[model samples]
Target: MNKLTPPTRLTGWGRATASGASVLPVSRGNIADAVVGAPERGALVRGLGRSYGDAAQNAGGLILRLAGLAGDAVLDTVQHTVTVGAGVSIDDLLRVTVPQGYFVPVTPGTRFVTIGGAIASDIHGKNHHGEGSFGNHVRRISLLLADGTTLEISPSQHTELFWATIGGMGLTGAIVDATISMLPIETSRCIVDTTRAHDLEHILTLMEEGDDRYRYSVAWIDLMAKGRHLGRSVLTRGDHATVEQLTGSATSSPRHYDPRVVASVPPVVPVSLINNLSVRAFNEFWFRKAPLYRTDEIHSLAGFFHPLDMVGSWNRIYGPRGFVQYQFLVPFGQEDALRHIVERFAASGAASFLAVLKRFGAGNAAPLSFPAPGWTLALDIPASFSGLGEILHELDHTVLDAGGRHYLAKDSHTTPQAISRGYPRLAEWQDVRNRSDPTGVWRSDLGRRLGLIA
Candidate 1:
């Protein structure tokens, strides 16, 4: 095993809550040795560090970087399935699969995330309502337990550990690799339908009625809009375009997949770039730019699923104070609570540039899984905003009261009390984790922060 590197500062994609840890980059062969020899603070596995919070950090202890374990994706073209190393990124996988007429069944907004991080977070995307989170498509995971034993876990095999590890935030074990089913696509384009809703009610009605017809759907809500315009949004929903739908030059190369980063944010930016006035103006321009009703618009896979990926280090735009990404889900009937939260953001003049709203389908058996049959809303707000902490706390209370829960991947400020209230099955998950790691060898800042483990 290699000696740990000098302690270095690390933070989530949100750039909030930075911490220092002794880091060790490990391959599959050396992972067990590093974990078993970890210091008193224990070890946590980190992948692409796309998590918005500290889910991957282990302060003062050994931090395992799995990027060395990455290898070429193994694909079964006929079965539409793939087995990838822990560090294989979604972008890397797609670059190979998309050209061969296949795509990831589910992908979060960013493609830079690793396969291990995706499973650890169980990320969901626009198609979550139709398919499910990354966990649903996961067939098996190779997890390295605290005792240095590697086990291949599936839903029906070692069921307890499997479920616990899905959304357990890497508290159970280190994920080495995963096998998942992929979605077959005829072309690397999406035939989308776009519509602009005047208000929250209009957008909700449209989605509730039409979402079932589409394979993927999502809305960019204007949280800065107040009064009657609260939650006014631009809804874009679509499915992979069929070969027959392609026209002109597109028909010649129907399976081309190329995503490029047009620009990157400089390392430093002024914190004031995202204030209320700027955000409101951007929102207004975005809302007015979309057609009231447009159908059959051809969009690249990257354009439709990951517009933000077009700009590298876009989070840097939030500046030195960093930002907070608050994502919460309320049950289907809790539309009132969703409305209230939107109202709160609008009334408080919160400058959220990227406010997304999506509908979730039934959640899987994973106790800590974030998705449920409900309406989910995600917002990006500056961490330095005055009263930001209090606002988030109040919002947490409202969500919990409505039988809602927050996404651990995006959470930074939620209290242990809110965690208990939101995830009632957490105790069950903990029990399973304890059995797999009796000495609690697996640990992370997120686990300690939420009191998920002792």
Candidate 2:
């Protein structure tokens, strides 16, 4: 039995009477017990619910919360690497690495995600044009399989499993530890240069024309901007600052927390995120504030790498119905198809608060890895979108036609046929998963949705 057991009640994610998620709150000590005795053929591994969709949701299956497993990040400046436990958070690692003048090779838009979350997502960063997804920099991974033994995996060792795990969305196994490269930074501050584009065409031109010049760059696309300004965006680029560049915050990792003093004002408050008027207002301001194709210099890595982390419970702004982040990739060869999608959204007025467009350079050997050489777009829409499923279904068709795929980490609405059509390597991924996780002991809403398990 492994002396294991599940929790009695769920906590933090949702406080609704109709929430079907019956996750009992398990402690760190008893976490192992949660999945230890799962004789069932299927199970799901979950970390923080930070994953935007059903990627972390298992309607009725065992969920091993890796975040509750352990949190440790040992940085080796000499080796330019960090060996970390799966539970460590990006924020936690940043707090330690900045003093040593190193940073994560890849990071999502926010710092609240755990290292395990990053691995599952195989998150890319602003520099994805220059760098690839995080998986590229991973030197190795230690996976705890359902059979309960840890496998040291890399491109050369257990090659199939390694790639499958990179963007497998935790369907492969429970990642226990990982060794990843830490980028060298002269200073924690960034010399940011901001520019705005009035339309989608300009945004693509800006990225293709000068993306390689900076270490990192990202744009905020105004989904609500219509007509002449459709796909309007503000592009921000930056490189790590040098000692001479820092004005007064000479400390390596400068922070951006003007709203934190009042942080305690709403401290300990559980904020709801799904609402209408609020999102409408937020989207407008976010779009109107940027310069129309101009530039500006900025500071602070916190704001540069993760602007959303500034507010503690920013997710609460989404309200009760919650939200879903739709992130998908469209290869260079499929620009027309991708453009059609954007055009469709523009026509329908699918207002989104956050819309990011990036160009990814290469992909992992992982049979199911999300990124391929392509242009990926991410948008946050209310889960309450009446036609969400239909819209996403349509997008899935577009992604497949473009020879691109969806990141399982941000996916909850994709279909099996779409996945099969999108990833030509899906069969190999299944073989690897079956070899490592026979009996389909790992299952999730995402898995069930896409029929990862028969």
Candidate 3:
């Protein structure tokens, strides 16, 4: 008789954990054969589990991790496409693609993410201002269904399933392989520019003006700013640096250089490290250290896209209890209301380490997908704050009244009423999902908590 091993917990960027009902690795041929024909009542596909929320957790059912599936991660430079197993990491993608002068069309702040997780979250990037999102560049995806059937889907073929699966967070089916377009760049460097905004107005003005001009655009918000200067930020914009721009710098070819990496996280980082005094000082240093304005031609891809990727296990900095990621979007016309939420955070005395602001264009084709034409903000806070959920719940109502919505990725506290008002397309998206997953083989805590499906 052989001893049995439990399935491992699926975790990505945010450091949280859940137990699997049972653990099974996908590569084992014995397991693959057994899984496909089960007609599962609740099965979910998980890749890197990099999603900021519980979209990847199946609660009490099957959590199919797509990474272990045996296959080659083949990239076709001629067609500017790559076919990777669902488990392929973005860090690996750069190793192979950067040398070939191509890059993933969209990437989040970290590179530990898997291909399946990226598709599951339909992750966006600094280029979202110009590229829309990662899903927009996907040409096709191959899904292994619950009943041993495989289908190749795209925008034109199996369009409903295609759209649903884009941001479906693996609920639709298991993604085995996907063909996506790659962006051609002059070099692996970005022409970096930073302009410190005195307040929220300055931040939005710059974003509204030049965000369209850059392939990568992001703003860092100093959430602790109070009084009339609340929500102050520094806007950074960039595009692939040209050879001519890098001429005067230390490195001629940015591609030939290596970046300094944080190979490991500190064994322990106290929650007090991110407190108001510390974050306030850090923000002040960031604001003052930045020049009024300057252009840097030499920037590495890792530094530009996944600065934190180099720091492995940085999430532990939030301490043992883990943390919560709050991502919300406010419509263009409701800028004042958005400011109100930021102001409320100031009054609440919460310390959020990472706060990001991005301006989104037209929403993507995924009905259940998060991005729309609005300004989106993301924040990471220690989960220990007893009043945190209550404050967030109030912000949820504020967001809804402002005609805005929260991102399903970084959400955990939003209520059902807010979810309904925030996402008007929920019913239609639900109908389509119910039709596809008639057996409800796919369900996550985010879905049930938000009343996405009964």
Candidate 4:
């Protein structure tokens, strides 16, 4: 087996925490050997590091970067599925599949994430209210267990292990490959409708009443707005545009799916560009830019879904201290709790330009999946903000009390108690995980912090 690289510091996308781990590249041929030789601290697979927290960080241990697993993707159009290496990224996948008239079943805010990370986090997107999470569409998974054994698991075979590995945060094993059902699309554009909501209640009413009509929906709220303007948002809902909807040049090449980075943040940003004053101004402009009510506006898939991806290394705008992305889900009846949290953030002058709210549909069988049938809100706040930890901790109580839970993939502030309260099926998942990893061979900073591992 090739030697592991010297210990190197790694951090999740949020960049709030960093740890040192020896990293190695492992293909299917050498993965078992890599796991067998893992240090006493154990080993965990690392993907694109898109997770906002420590889930992919294995401090003082080994981090395996999956490589050369079955090579290029094998698209089976007949079955409407793609069997691909877990290392394949959504960005790369789209470039190939979109032109071929297919799209991933589910995609989060960004397309830079890997297939393995999507399954591990069981990532959801705006259309979650209609399509469920990524795991729901997965037909099968090739997993490398803790003891250097490989197993092909599906919903019907090794059922318990299959669900456990989904959203198990990589503790159950290293995912090598997967077969996922794909969505067929006629073009790379979305026929979007935009509506500006004046307050929290207005936005909630709009989404609750009309979300079911669209395949994808999301609302961007101005968290800095106060009182009458609290939770003021721009709601955008849409579905893939059919070829008939395209005109002129678009019609000539409907599936042309090349997305590019339009701009980039400099490497050295000494301090955060975000603050109450700046965010307030930006919020006002953002709100005014959207029409009070607009319909059938054609938007590129990247523009509508992963706008942040257009600005390369945009996280650097938060400066050297980085930022924290706090995302939580509240069950349907917990609208009161959702309102209170939004009110709190607005009142506190939390400078978050990226606050968004979406309604999730029924969750899958994954014990640790973040989405459920409820409202979910995600926002990014500068970590250097004063009393930020205390505020988030206080909100955790409200969330848990309302039968809501924080998303582990985006978590950096939630505690072990909060996690326990959030995921009732956690212990059941642990039971399956422990059985598969009897020697406790797989580990990560998140697993340790959240008490996911004994």
Candidate 5:
């Protein structure tokens, strides 16, 4: 077993909530040993720390960070799948697979997340309206349970446990590795279509009318817009470009894929630069810069999907108090609830610059998965804003009443009662989790706060 590092203070990508835990670097070879010796506080596996919340945190417990999990990425061209160690990140996976004319079946907004984290969180992307989330494409998983026993699970094997682990928030067990079905692509670029919507209803109607034609779709909303321009947005939708769509030099190496960080935010920002005035100005500039309607515009994959990744430590812009990413999903037939929340944000001058709106398809059987047939909106707000807690808590009631739920991966607020109201299958999932972790060996701060464990 590797030596355990002293208790280290760790925070999520949002840098809002933090906890201290002894971090131990464990590999496939020594994980069982480590699990057998976990302390009374129990243990939890942490990935690259992108969860924006406390899902991967374990206060005063053992935090296992997988090492040597990416032993090798074995690609099976005929099967259109790749079996890789769970510790491998989507960023590294893309660097290998994209060059081979393939892409991940689903990816979140950022590429820095580990495959283990992706599966645990069941991340969804802009393409979710068609392809579903990451768990949908996963063929199999190697799970290390609380009893120090390793099990190979899939849709048809240990079926219930597999689904429970999909969005179980890493409380089910430690994911060792996985085999994922990859998407075949002709090029590493995308052919995009852009449109500017005048208001919330306009954008929602446009997406409802035409989203089926594209494989990926997302809208960036201007929350600061009010009155006639409430929810004004820049909608971008597209799919991987074919080789024929490339022009000039790009056509020569259409499959070549390389992404690099262009800049970084300094570490010592004292106050959040994101405020009402600055966000309003930025939103205006963003809305104006996008073409009124542009089609067939070629774009690199990195530019279209993960533009924020280009700026390293971008969260630092939110300053020392940090920020919270509140994402909620209201099911179909609940458009009124969605509108009410949007209006609330607009009226409150929330100063949210990164508001995103997407339409989700039907969700799978993952008991804890966040998405359903719904309209989901995600936004970031400075944590130190006055009366922020009251505003979010009030909104939680509205969301729960409308049969909506919050995303645990991005949640730093929201209460246990809210979670119970949101996920009807919570008891079912907890039963399965408890049976596997009879002694409550696998645990996390998220689980305890949300009463996920018995």
Candidate 6:
């Protein structure tokens, strides 16, 4: 066992808030010991720390860094399934599986997330309309309970605990490993279609009409545009490219998979670099650069699904104060509410450079899961912006009133009242959690702040 590191300052990917905790790196063999000997502040498992908010932080507590628990991925090609360590990142898993003609059934925008993080947050992706969130593909999970007991949980066994742990945000317990179903593919490329929507209505209509035709779809909206151009967007939709679609070297090596980070942001930058004026200009250029109508463009898997991954430490561009990723989902019928929220962001002069919109299909049984059959929009706003908190709080009410909810993975400021209203299954989730961890051994900053754990 490795010695525990001294109390260190840690923050989420957003880097807006900071907390200090003693980080203990533990392997599967020693995880039990660490949990059993945890301090009064309790312990929480942490993965790659990609959550945009405090979901993984445990102030004054013991942080179990699971990276040391990584093990080789066991692939069962016959069953199209893989059992990977909780610490294994999606990027690492893809490096091995993509060449084997298989891919993660569901992947978020960034491939740096760990398997444990994926299960804890029930991450969704562009293909959610077709395959649902990561939890849908999960076959089994090895969880370490607060009582230092390790249990193998599946949908049919320990069913309630399994579902609650899906989006339980690591409060259920420390995920040790997981067996997941993989999606087979002929190649590592995607056959993509692109179109530019003139306004909010046009884009929503286009997505509603044709999104089902593609396996993956997403729209990049220009939140800075107002009036006639309000919510103008570039819609890109696609699926894994077939072998026949590949040519030359790609045809012979159709399963080739390699993702590289082309650039890294400086350690520090001036907040002024991301002001409304600069972001608006960038958004305009970005929108104009997309083809009015393009079809069947072959793109690498990384290029298509994780563009931001191409730039390492890209969040540094947001400067010292970092940025907030506010993502909310409204049911299919709440188009008016979606439009109202977009209009509010446009009118607020918020400097949001990465604004994305996607449609989610039916949600799974995870009580805290963010997706539903609705329209979901995610925006990256500079945290230094004045009145940004107020703007988001108001948006929260609008979303809740529309029968929608915010993604806990990206939330830092949403009130507990809003959470209770959004997730009606909270009581059910809490019941399962309490039974599983009556002593409250599993805890996090998010859990305490939101009253997720009693």
List the RMSD of every prediction in angstroms.
1.2, 3.6, 2.8, 1.3, 1.2, 1.5
User: Candidate 2: RMSD over Cα atoms?
Assistant: 3.6
lDDT of 1 by residue, 85-142 (tens): 8878899889988998889999999999988888888899999898989999999999
* All candidates: TM-score: 0.98, 0.88, 0.92, 0.98, 0.98, 0.98
Our model 3 lands, by Cα RMSD against the true structure, at 2.8
Q: How well does candidate 6 match the true structure in TM-score terms? A: 0.98
Error of 4 at 37 (Å): 0.7
lDDT of 6 by residue, 1-454 (tens): 3255678898999988789989988788889999988887889999998999898899989999886322388999999999999989999999999999999999999999999999999999999998899999999999999989999999998999999999999988999999999999999999999999999999999999999999999999999999999999999999999999987778878998888999988777766468887898899899999999999999999999999999998888888898899999999999999999999999998899889999999999888888899999999998888999998899899999999998999988888888889999999999999999888888898887877776
The CA lDDT of each predicted structure is: 0.91, 0.72, 0.75, 0.92, 0.92, 0.91
Task: Kindly list the per-residue Cα lDDT of model 3 for residues 125-183, writing each as its tens digit.
Answer: 78777888788988999876655567899999899888888877777777777888888
Question: What lDDT does model 1 reach?
Answer: 0.91
Q: Name the Cα RMSD for model 5.
A: 1.2
Per-residue CA lDDT of candidate 2, range 1-454, in tens? 3332443233223222121343534443444455556645345666766776667766545556655322357888899999987777777777777777788898888777777778877888888888888888899998877775668999889888999898888888777779999998877677888887888999889988898888788878877667888788888888887766767545544432222212412433344444455656876777677655544365777768777667665655655665677788888878887677777777666657678888788777777778888899988776667787788888788778778787776765677887787778888888888998876767766677787666
Candidate 6, superposed: residue stretches over 4 Å from native? 1-5, 68-71, 270-272
Over the full model, what C-alpha lDDT does candidate 6 score relative to the true structure?
0.91
For model 5, what is the alpha-carbon lDDT of residue 287? 99
Candidate 4 clash pair list: none
Error of 1 at 212 (Å): 0.4
- Compare candidates 2 and 5 on lDDT and give the better one: 5
lDDT of 4 at 385: 90
